[model samples]
Target chain A: MASARSDRRISADHIPVKLVIAGPFGVGKTTIVGALSEIEPLNTEEVLTQAGTLVDDLTGVNEKTTTTTAIDFGRLTLPGVVLYLFGAPGQTRFQVLWDELVRGALGVLVLADTRRIDDSFAVLDLVENAGIRYAVAVNHFPDSPQYPPEALRQALDLDPRTPLLVCDARDPASARASLIALVEHIRELVLS
Target chain B: MTSGRQRRRVVPDYMAAARLSVPEHISVERTTLVSIAADADAGGLDPPASHLLALLRDEPLSVYECAAHLGLPYCVVRLLVAGLVGNGTLLTRDPPPSDLPDIEILELVLSGLRAL
Candidate 1:
């Protein structure tokens, strides 16, 4: 009976996977991770005092108070599968730290606030520079006018094979759907 | 509102460099940060050093503690501390508190975080 149980556990070992949520400053990378995680999320946050404004970019996140300093982490478990979610550090200067964060992640979910689309480019470039597979989630802001998906694709210069979808970072259902799209994209990569 | 000019006085590079020197065994270069700040602020304090000085005001903490106080990481602190200490605003004693465990210190940090 012990041997049988051990064999069953061994088969279950590889069920869960890791997914990363990455984006630029103030783009809700942590919010998306928290919304989907089954467990209480752990994040390292620091107040974005006036001092940071001089050093880090403050174009879109002008009114921001705090930002992730280290990583924000959460977990989502499925039937015999667990998805570990990690939120990347939000500053461009912190780009050097990504290799360690993305080490074992299966794929990345790149969040973009349509109000400030250019901010997303830094994150997308980092993922591409690292040669990891990623999908983009355009988190809608209330005032952001809708635009054609293809136009956004061209604007961001996204590859044809990369998945791009709309999401409301504040809504769990919408965030979950975006993550599912990322999972499906990764699976498709495997199949190909 | 932001001021275009920062306050600068008569502080020479050698004096700035001598005071900021850290005797710690850590791999950080305390002197290089001063030159960068001198270059950027045109011989005035760079904005990031203000954040680091606030952290150093309390104690000769590790690179990690400075990061926590600023809501940043050792990466940010390492850069800023090297500059401030090199410029004589703060002093760094490196080689760190030895590898030997200090149970009391661990409990104090945990207690501090809990209190926070």
Candidate 2:
């Protein structure tokens, strides 16, 4: 594959490809991107005023005077391809921007925390609704109870084909594995 | 509680100042990448727009990246980028790609990750 792509380097005219890394707050979405990014991830913030708060469901979130929506991004450049990994903001209020963010994304990686399993639902729903193929990565947290693969899969009510695996977001190798799973899933979708 | 948007009735000084130079018709996407157009005259642009031209003189950058580099708010940078794009001082690039990665590239990416 590398030999085949040697001649396909992305030009200034070609659109840059992106893959979204999504999950709820405190789920290590940024950590995963940071681990995988070759350069230090860049975080871009947008101010969310009180009017924006009305639509946000901040149940598990810490209190804040003025909400700052942040999206962290990293880039991976190969011989012929330039892929960007963008971490999606976890808050529901930021849903307004999802369409724009996901507009040209290749696929999405939805990180799930076993402790807050339900927290992944909203993001999963958004990805599914966007008609983007996605894979769920259960971020391995020390305190979270461990479950069998089937149990975790059933809890998330995932499609039998959806890839689900446990990964340590802080570890680059583990994070890359999750991304690989997502890319493979995207390939399957395309081929089918 | 008074809403933050409702309470901040007085326009910010910078915004008021920018209103003098930036026209209203210009609009920009949050993620738009802006680069200086070949015909643009940096000296004729507003201070903010001039700074943008300097930043993009070498290469294009997304409006979000510009905001971070300029230490300005995203909305403020968007306005600046929009103004430049509207006046033909700046040009926008192709949007991000939505298609699947090429089979060869996808395999290569997976292999590269494994090798790393």
- Give the best candidate by DockQ: 2
- Point out where model 2 deviates above 4 Å: A1-14, A47-68, B1-31, B38-40, B96-116
B18-103: candidate 1 lDDT, tens digit per residue? 43434354345211111122223323554445545544443233343344344444445565566555544554432212122233
True-vs-predicted CA distance for residue A183, candidate 2, Å? 1.6
True contacts kept of each: 0.00, 0.39
Interface RMSD of each: 19.8, 6.5
**Pairs in steric clash, model 2:** none
Candidate 2, lDDT over the whole model: 0.70
DockQ each: 0.02, 0.25
What tier of docking accuracy does candidate 2 attain? acceptable
lDDT leader: 2
Q: Model 1: which residue pairs collide?
A: A16-A82, B20-B85, B24-B94, B24-B95, B25-B94, B25-B95
Q: Give TM-scores of the second chain, every candidate.
A: 0.41, 0.63
Kindly list the per-residue Cα lDDT of model 2 for residues B21-79, writing each as its tens digit: 46677545544556677787777666666666776766566666666656566677777
TM-score of chain A of each: 0.84, 0.83
Per-residue error for A111 in candidate 1, Å, reads 0.6
Q: Write model 2 residue lDDT over A99-150, tens digit each, in one string.
A: 7778777788999888788888888889878888889999988777889999
* Best candidate (score: TM-score): 2
